[model samples]
Target: MTSAAAVASPATVRPSRGLAVFWIVAGLFGVATSFLLYLEYVGQLTGADPIVSCSFSPIVTCGPNLLSPGGNLLGFSNSIIGVVLFWGPVYAGVSSLAAPGGMRRWYWRVYSLFIAGAFLFVHFLAYRSVFEYGSLCPWCMTVWLATIPLFWFTVSWTLREGVWGTGAGTRRVGAAVYSWALLLTVLDYAVIAIAAQLRLDVIGSLF
Candidate 1:
């Protein structure tokens, strides 16, 4: 019984640590991204272009991006959403470390689902900003980039916890789903980067 318990303990403890690390890294990046967005938001409110003030210059302008229709998703600024979504995960990750037994499995599962929903929403907004708005908010893109790791790590952690299931069939299907999501995200970013580059080139050529 002692040996059996020891084996099971490793499985639970090791994965939890790994998941905690994932959330910590994601939270740190999210916090940094939020700070940048806050600066830009402050600049917009005060009638100054923060990106230009920061020396990003002609190629990147937070002002235009913030003013775009996509920036006000559902009538609220995107940074506001980032603040709510990111701070929760950051708090959760930190609290887990300090508390006894850390966070529970169900807590992680529910939190992961919440973050997943946010990720989907943000991805949609990102697509609109890139394809329809025709501008990239550097701060917004940073949030998007940070969100990827948050989503990926959460999903990975959930899988390792066997929250979905432990059967071979379940594992196979889960792996496939994760792989497809990752592939789609990569393809989407690649297309957006290529399109943005082309747009910039065209504008440059005209001048």
Candidate 2:
């Protein structure tokens, strides 16, 4: 029978510095973008002008989305959620860098779950913004931009590290997917871009 120490020290892949750096950059970008949106929301509450820096036109602005019912779907500004949760990636990256021995499988599993939820939520917001509001929110788009990669990379890394499974086949599949994480992220961006263009004529509005 395997000893307790052996069972606890199962061989597994560790997160690399590159992945850590990506998380840090993406997290910071998300935090900054969300904070800007939150400040805009605060401005609106103070009876300030609706037309803010990110507002370019009626079809391509954040003002309506910010004031709309969907903006406060959870009884407060969605940007506040973004500002608060974006730090998770930053903290994970810092921890990985500080302790290169790597985190436990359970920790990564929970983190991946959090990122998955964020991925779905951002896309849902995107759909509502395009179909319901018929507007393109620049700050919200930035949040989506940051989240897309964060989701893909975190999933990929967790897979490669055996957080999902430790079997040889599982790790192989994880390695394959990890190598394509960037392409997957780009494809995701393309899907959102296509949807936005079809519904809102985003390109035409910009020109």
- The parts of candidate 1 lying over 4 Å away from their true place are 1-14, 49-59, 99-102, 173-191, 198-207
Q: Pick the candidate with the highest lDDT.
A: 2
Worst ten in a row by lDDT for model 1: 1-10
What C-alpha lDDT, on a 0 to 100 scale, does residue 110 get in candidate 1? 80
Off by over 4 Å in 2: 1-8, 11-13, 49-52
- For residue 123, model 1's alpha carbon misses the true position, in angstroms, by 1.4
User: Top model by TM-score, which number?
Assistant: 2
Candidate 2 global lDDT: 0.82
For residues 29-58, write the lDDT of model 2, one tens digit per residue.
999999999988887778676434887766
